[model samples]
Target: MEVKQNNLIKSLRIQPLIVVIRLENNFFNISDKRENLLLKIEKLSNCGIKNIEIGWDSNPEWVNLILQIKKKFKSINIGVASITSRQSLDSIRSLDINYSMSPYFNKEIHLKAIKYNQLVIPGISNIENFKEAINLGYKIVKIYPASKLGVKFINELQGFKKKDMFFIGAGGIKSKNLKSLLKLGYDALVIGKELRNQKPDKDLKIWLKNC
Candidate 1:
């Protein structure tokens, strides 16, 4: 399948609250609860979650499922996991997704993914990764450990680069920090295990209120 981006720049302009894909392959027994969990996801969407993500770690079925889920949520925006193929975009190209991001953007596979109109976002830290990502033409940069770096880190980063280069902090984010992170001028950030854990909608409401 070939991916063609329609209004790609417009879609990328939004402030994203991405929930990364997490398969509970250990500890928690989710095998018998797929349907219920899917229901929960649907409910979350209904409750106004416009930004979401699917972390497909070499799984076509997962990508297909995410497509199906998207069919039901016409108003939502979705993104795929990071691409780190040593050979570049080979593996990511096959997924045919809207966006592809990762802790690293090795050549080849990444180039191929870009050809398909995938919005590539590479994880970066310090001057080296930032320069490399910009050189590679990735407008979005995921700041791996946002919690540790906080506002100070981003301020330091903007000093050297253009502020419009969509910056996202995803490693250790929580609902409590969303507003603060936003205030820091970060384009977006991911809520890690916080969203993965089962919690009541009321709790989510309270968290959002505080945020």
Candidate 2:
């Protein structure tokens, strides 16, 4: 199933514009972590790029560093990520972040994020979790291993929603699948290894244009 091109989304959203940066892998200058994060955030800001999600579950220092990033770059939106880790709202309530996401969902974490009024995108790979999130008031859902399931399945899910719900795709995203994601019903995407090899700035711009 393909979207019939909604004029509202075309006008309001820069479709296919979500950039998910694995803070650990993308910013590889591990010698000085804080400085590394600042440099990446500042560079992206200088490039006139905005919207970034930083993943952290064990790196509590990331919470503080992200605050500094927000202070330094007011235009950028910061998000937190937890995958198969113990990241919880207790860890993030003090630090300022826009959202909390996981490659899979947990009832406790989801409930906590909701209480904090933090946007949460729980990952679900199958129909049961999908139905549960929809029933539990999730506006955004992450589709893990998006490359394996591919855009075809996402297109099928799009048919069930009345409004455009956020269907975020991760894993195995590349230049080849970018167009198909847009053609399908996915609302956003995250990348890691794809950006690690490219001229980050140029490739991002080219991707933005295509999305």
Candidate 3:
């Protein structure tokens, strides 16, 4: 049988929008609020967003929720982000996850993820880490805490990079500024905490369209 392509990278080739759903205390409440979470994802899907990140917060049960989402939305590329250790990769790998991302660059962690044949996107900020990631053949990377770095930094980095490395703008991303970042040529955006709104269905619909 032919092996399938990694969904995260495949989705990027299709579009550059990603909705990051953080499984925080909400994971504990998923049993009761499952439909609401599903609805939020459904709204994003309907709006043409096909990639999502399930922010891992040290909760093992969170993988179960990811499995559920994958089963329900076969076309959506679901990945676990905020990874820091080999253990996190192991857990996600056990679930047959095809993609993952970390908040910072770590050679060991990157190697381990590669060993699992996972499409690993490491966080990059300054020139040094970005160079190292590219040296390791990472074509796509995440610009984390982008709110702190601001749009100017991203513009400057994109202007000076060796190759056209795709960037996923994450950390403190909001619906208001998402379009501006996209206009600035960010390859993708990962919206998390701020997305858990009282009106997720309406908000997601608008946000996805705005992007």
The clash count for each model shown is: 8, 0, 0
As for TM-score, the candidate ahead, 2 or 3, is 3
- Provide the overall lDDT of each model, using Cα atoms, as 2-decimal numbers: 0.62, 0.64, 0.73
What does candidate 2 score on TM? 0.79
Q: How many pairs in model 1 have backbone atoms within 3 A of each other, for residues 3 or more apart or on separate chains, i.e. clashes?
A: 8
Q: RMSD for each model, in Å, please?
A: 4.0, 5.4, 3.3
Q: Which candidate is the best by TM-score?
A: 3
Q: Candidate 3: lDDT of 150?
A: 84
Give candidate 2 regions above 4 Å deviation.
Answer: 1-12, 25-31, 83-87, 197-201, 209-211
When 2 and 3 are scored with lDDT, the better candidate is 3
Per residue, candidate 1 scores C-alpha lDDT tens digits across 1-211 of: 1223333334534535676665555312455555654676676676656566755545445555666666766676766665666333454455445665776545565566566666667677676778777776766678877776667778877887764477778887777667667777776677757654633346455654554
User: Residue 153 in model 2: shift from native, Å?
Assistant: 1.8
- For model 2, state the Cα shift of residue 82 in Å: 1.5
Error of 2 at 40 (Å): 2.0
List runs of model 1 lying over 4 Å from the truth: 1-15, 26-33, 86-96, 196-211
Each prediction's TM-score against the native?
Answer: 0.78, 0.79, 0.83
lDDT of 2 by residue, 1-211 (tens): 0121232124226544445656655343476855765776667656545567666645556666667777888877666766343355577677756665788877676666666665567887876778777776775678988888876678777766547466778877775566667567667677656765222556566666554
| After superposition, candidate 3 runs with Cα above 4 Å error | 1-10, 198-207
